[model samples]
Target chain A: MQLALGPLLYCWPREQVLSFYEQAAGWPVEIVYLGEVVCSKRRVLSLDEWLDLAKHLESAGKQVVLSTLTLLEAGSELGALRRLCRNGHFDVEANDMAAVNILAAAGVEFIGGPTLNIYNPRTLAVLVGQGLRRWVLPFELSHPAASELINAAPASCTCEVFAWGRLPLSWSARCYTARAENRAKDQCEIICRNDPDGRLVSTREGQPFLTINGVQMQSALTQDLAPWIPEMEAAGIQVLRLSPQYSGMDEVVECFDRLRRDPGDQEVLRRLQSLAAVGVCDGYWHGEAGFANTANGLQQS
Target chain B: MQRMKLVCPAGNLPSLRAAVDGGADAVYLGFRDATNARHFAGLNFSRDSIQQGVQYAHGHGCKVFVAINTYPQPQGWTQWQRAVDEAADLGADALILADTGLLDYATRRWPDVARHLSVQASATNPEALSFYHRLFDIRRAVLPRVLSLRQVARLIEHSPVPVEVFGFGSLCVMAEGRCLLSSYVTGRSPNTYGACSPASHVRWEETDQGLESRLNEVLIDRYGPGEQAGYPTICKGRFRVGEHVYYAMEEPTSLNTLDILPELMRAGVAAIKVEGRQRSPAYVAQVTAVMRAAIDACLADPQAYKPHAAWQQALASVSEGTQTTLGAYHRPWL
Candidate 1:
């Protein structure tokens, strides 16, 4: 029944990232994940700077977790990850297995990021043995699928589900944002900064399909599982993670906060749908196409 | 240095025989169920057929690797476990696994059998390989397609186990295990269903614009009449981004590492892999034969090895794209 803010996936300006965290200090969420989880090229917030923000957020009475990059390519990125794992102040969310290995070797208890792909209990159990404290259910897991794994997971290990935001569907070595601009990954300007929430990629028929943010591809529509709040509770999900979007992030957090207090809050759901980047989808939860959303009465289009 | 092992993929018994007869040091295949990554209709081996394949490969002094790479779900957990037992019983030389839990089970029950990490695990760096090696005692690890040549060389230098890199096949622009673009459109992903852009959901429609490929009613791409269309996966398809329509992710192509075989061999890669288990026996035979020659040429004279034009032409004819690139192996590919 607790709310947590997931890592920021976009490449925002330094001032915007700082101001967002400063405002987040007063938000109702108890836990906040901060760091660059998309492209390692995003250095708007350095590890030292992220640690400074973590210290400030900790003072603001919030538990902080440092998130690692989803795709680790260069040795320099590995060096950055080594620093994150050895931060010693806050727990780290291991996004890739290299981070997991470093944290486990250091004997540091860490949160498993969604990209770790903890699909089965044995995977969770193996991670639990290797110092996994909690795990974020991967974005693709359906409601029943999540429940099965959560049930089979060790009793002490907690489960967190991505409650609201654009679903991060895939990661590639090639940067689509750069490719879309007809630029090479090297020698190209950091053009991703131009689109804060990611550039929208639509079908040839002009239907929104996905959003490209550097190497990550996300669903064009927002995924809101607030309508299934009761089901998550019934399945013993300890926390619901709300990913940080450029706009309306605080409102998304507030709506979830209100809905948790009153599961039947109809007005809150209506406002949440309006906040959808294009439309709302909870289809992955329904065991249907990830872009389909019908159970919550949210329009798929 | 020892000659690098050449691993070829086989979907059926015929493909397995083709790989072995075509000079594959090891032939990797999956059961005809969801236990492996390449779960497709009329593909993969049944228990009896795999037993026959093992006998054939073993008799030919070749190794057979059984792939149980997909993450096992709650409902199908026991099925995956049983597949591990079956592959072991069939005398598989190694088990190419991606799931940690399944690796845990296989490690505990059949500690003697060699376990190779499947590329579906997407363990890109040296530390990740170390983790898998430390935990599962995996003997070999197939590197994901996302690493550069320098990255792959650096990893091999520090890896606890021998490393395998893809030599030729249809290219995967994304990290293998982590991508879910297929599930978003078709509701079946590589991790969950062992199929990306499952053929069941694919539909080809001819419209005014030309031929269009749709997955679960979502238009993936449109092809001109003379355009040689490849497979209908989301990443390789053309889409619109800010008034532009093109292959924003990746073009349909193959990862031809023949040009860089000497570099990979010199870097101490343990094996060269040909990735196309879902393809035909002919595709397997052609790739295995060409790669066998390429690896041998590189090993014979690392300083003077040059990829022959004939080898390139032979590979291009069977490639998914008209041409091939070194893929993420080259620094500029990223």
Candidate 2:
């Protein structure tokens, strides 16, 4: 399976974002989705800078796609979506229907972003009719469902699953990350950049649970399907997306590279355990609750 | 001016029946499955109940809108699609939709069915509204709570479809259709699973620090004996930013737009929506009845009608408690 690097969900300094992409140039991933998928207030990297980086990544042999804001609030966000549709240099990942309509009206072939919520073969066919080239499975869809959908994708569509990283479960217009810092969204001061892996939320019992990433909420556990490589391949998944985290992504990519090289390697899970953050879950893949980890050889009770 | 329709939520058959009987002009509900946004257990309608509900609402001269609003997963589109087909077959007046693919499917599969855009679509502008209207032939759009009155006015001016505004319910401080906070913590999203701050992920503890509310093993809120605790979500929880610990995302507020009824009506809004789908049947009946009377009184005489103190008190009793904001309708920045 090919590796696809997802758009950076967390807000980062412009320098940090540039440096992250700079390092990603040499990573084994084949596709890199650039642009903000969360809040639009963040001006870490302007559209021009993102396009410039897209060129660099493309030159380094990676296919690039510009992602639209998951939540389009005002006229300005719609204008940005229009610009992304007109960018011309790379494919667009339509996160919302407005983006899809923008792309379809312009006759731009786009990847159906995970947030598009494609649930069955018929919806896939509908999007494909509307010019869908590739589609990412929503975070909550199980592996069996994904397998069925992948097998059912139209001839022209590529099926990619968010195989690794903390699943981005939702996006909102309200800035939770800023709220976590006791600030209004307008005066958030880009405080979300401080928590690179997202601010971890713990239960009263000190159980690691969720993470706050600005307007987006994610799982505290980095979901990994490294051990499920055999099943994914068997299921006909073309690409496995690994979302960028705050740190240790290079090591994470390297670990995935090794697994791709030897899909049958029994010790991949043991090696991955040392590298992944706190918890590992592939429950959504197994058609169970998302937190259930099928990799540990233990079925969820 | 004609009285705007008061569309209220009915999580289950009892709430559905209560909302219709409680004087709602129309009651909107979803099936027990994932097709609707309120997918909490013991909530939402079953197939037989939905059919019965349509008949009951029609008998009462009330309309029924089935919310097949959740985003359909690629592998699970069958349930959502079938729900829409069944809703159409059952003679439901409308279907509240969010996903583009599903919207396209509903429009193509059931051209005769009326389509109301769910808040989950987050279509806040004229262009977005027009796009949905042109593509899906959507008759109405539920304005996201993030819009101010001016924005809503502008939208109504340019929108090809009629606008529906949230008059009351749980105020999603964050934009609806876009928030993933609940899914991040509980592994269930309102967009994907029709659940927000699901109960399975929530737990409260009384400790030396006071009452702590937790989700997915994370301490999202800590309440002193007197301080009211909001629902648990990473953003809604009290956290330290530099030196301040407060409700960062939202301070647990319910939207009470009763006072602003005149403003929304003046803005040419076509309908007023109330937001509780997971609340009790009694809560639905009380809120709907109060709002129905409040709207009627306002339309009959805006100059003499004061925001009912009793309505406010009853709403407060069922609300999240401690905090209430007009939400984005009055906000300069939402």
Candidate 3:
């Protein structure tokens, strides 16, 4: 199975984003998803800049796919989606159905992001008919469910699973980050840049429960599926998607790369656990609570 | 302007009858399983009950809609398929579906039956709405509670199909189908299990600190003395972010669009949906009655339309937190 870098879901400085891609060009991953899948207001990297980065990554032997936003409420966001669909040079990962509609109508083959909510074989078949080439499995799917969907998928459609990173739990119109800072979504300055990894939201009992990205709520636990590589491979998962984090992404990619080459490496799993910024969880894979760390046999803290 | 249809929720046979008798133009319900979003214990309709409910609604000159909205697992796709077939056989007016797979199945098998895109589909844009309409031949699409009035107006102007907006309901702070907060905490979610923050996993503990509401052992919120504690939906819970503790997403409040009844009607909204399927028959009757009156008043005199004070009081009495907001309809909320 090949490792694919999922879209960057957090806001970062333009320089940091550029340098991260520059460094990622040489990483062990074969495919890189470049674009903002979170808040559309995060315009640190414009479409032209994203296209430029996509070109640079292509030159470095990495297949780049531009991702559309998960939620679209404004015409400006739809306009951006139109541009992304018609970029012409690179494949677009359609996160919402708006992107799917635009790309399918344009007769462009696109990758289906996890948020598209494809579960049954018929949905997969329909999208495949609409020119879907690859589909990222929704994060909440259990191992057996993912395997079933992948096995039932059309022959031409590849299946990718979210293998690493904090699970993006939900998206909202209200920017939780801005709300936390006591500002309206429109009037608030782009304050999400202050949190490269997203701000942690802890329970009243002081246990980390979720992470507040601009408009998205993510799990506090970083999901590590490295321990289940063999199961994923056996299930015919073609690609493993590792979402970009603030730091140590290269090391994370390297660990996954090594595990892809050699599936039975316990040391690599340990290294991945150490590289995680939060506690590791594999519960959703086991049909358990998403925050539960089934690999470690521990309840969610 | 068309008289806005008042769609009411029916969790059971009684609720379905109540909605139909309480002046609902239409009543939407679900089967007693995970095929629909309100799969709670002692809630939802049995196969026989759905038939009876449909008959009652049809007898009362009201339409009946069956919501088969949850994303079906690959192995359990047949259950959802059976639901569509049953809804059609029961002579339901429409089938509210979210999964594209089920939409495909329903349209292919029962082409004559009307299909309305459930809000759980999260098709917030005209492009998405047009795509579903073109592909599945959906008659109408429910707008997610995340769009502002201006956005709704634009979408209505551009949409290829008719649009329905939520009028009164408990607010989901996040997009409906995409939220995994329930699954993250309790392993069952609205998308998969058709329930959010399932009561089986919830615990209310009285402690020295306060009355703590926990969902699957995670403290959602702690209420102080005399503080009105709402149900522990993870989104409305207070959480500590950095040095501050507050409702990071939103406070526990219901959505009441009574004041904007005229605006919505002027924007060409076809229907107003009241969203409490798990509520009691009384709750369904009250909400459906208020919304029915409000829509009629707004459509009767669009220029001089004003919300009734009694309607607000009736809705607030049944609201989760005894308060209401326009939710995403107001730009400031976003």
User: Ten consecutive residues with minimal summed lDDT in candidate 1 chain B?
Assistant: B293-302
Per-prediction TM-score? 0.98, 0.88, 0.98
- lDDT score of residue B82 within candidate 2: 90
DockQ (C-alpha based) per candidate is 0.82, 0.32, 0.86
Off by over 4 Å in 1: A296-301
RMSD of each: 1.3, 3.6, 1.6
- Which candidate gets the maximum lDDT versus the true structure? 3
- What are the Cα lDDT values of the candidates? 0.90, 0.80, 0.91
Residue pairs in clash, model 1: none
Per-residue lDDT for B1-334 in model 1, tens only?
6679899999998988999999999999999888888889999898899999999999999999999999887788899999999999999999999999999999999999999999999898888888898999999999889988888888888889999989999888889999899998877899999999999999998999999999888888999989987779999888998888998788888889988888898899999989999989999898888888888887889898998889899899998877899988886877
What digit string (tens of lDDT, one per residue) describes model 1 on residues A9-87? Answer: 8988889999999999999999999999998887887788999999999999999999998888788888999999999
Q: How far is candidate 1 from the true structure (C-alpha RMSD, Å)?
A: 1.3
- Kindly list the per-residue Cα lDDT of model 3 for residues B133-166, writing each as its tens digit: 9899999999888999999999999899999999
Error of model 1, residue B303, in angstroms: 1.5
Q: What stretches of model 2 exceed 4 Å from their correct place?
A: A264-272, A297-301, B1-3, B11-18, B32-34, B40-52, B71-82, B99-102, B126-128, B174-193, B196-249, B297-306, B330-334
lDDT tens readout by residue for model 2, B1-334: 3568899898877888898888899899988877888888888787898888898899999999989888876656777889988999999999998887788888988999899999888787776677788778999999888777777877787778888999988887666776666655566778778887788888998988898887766678788877876767555566543344555456677888888887788888889999998889999998998999999987888778788788888888888764467877775335
Off by over 4 Å in 3: A297-301
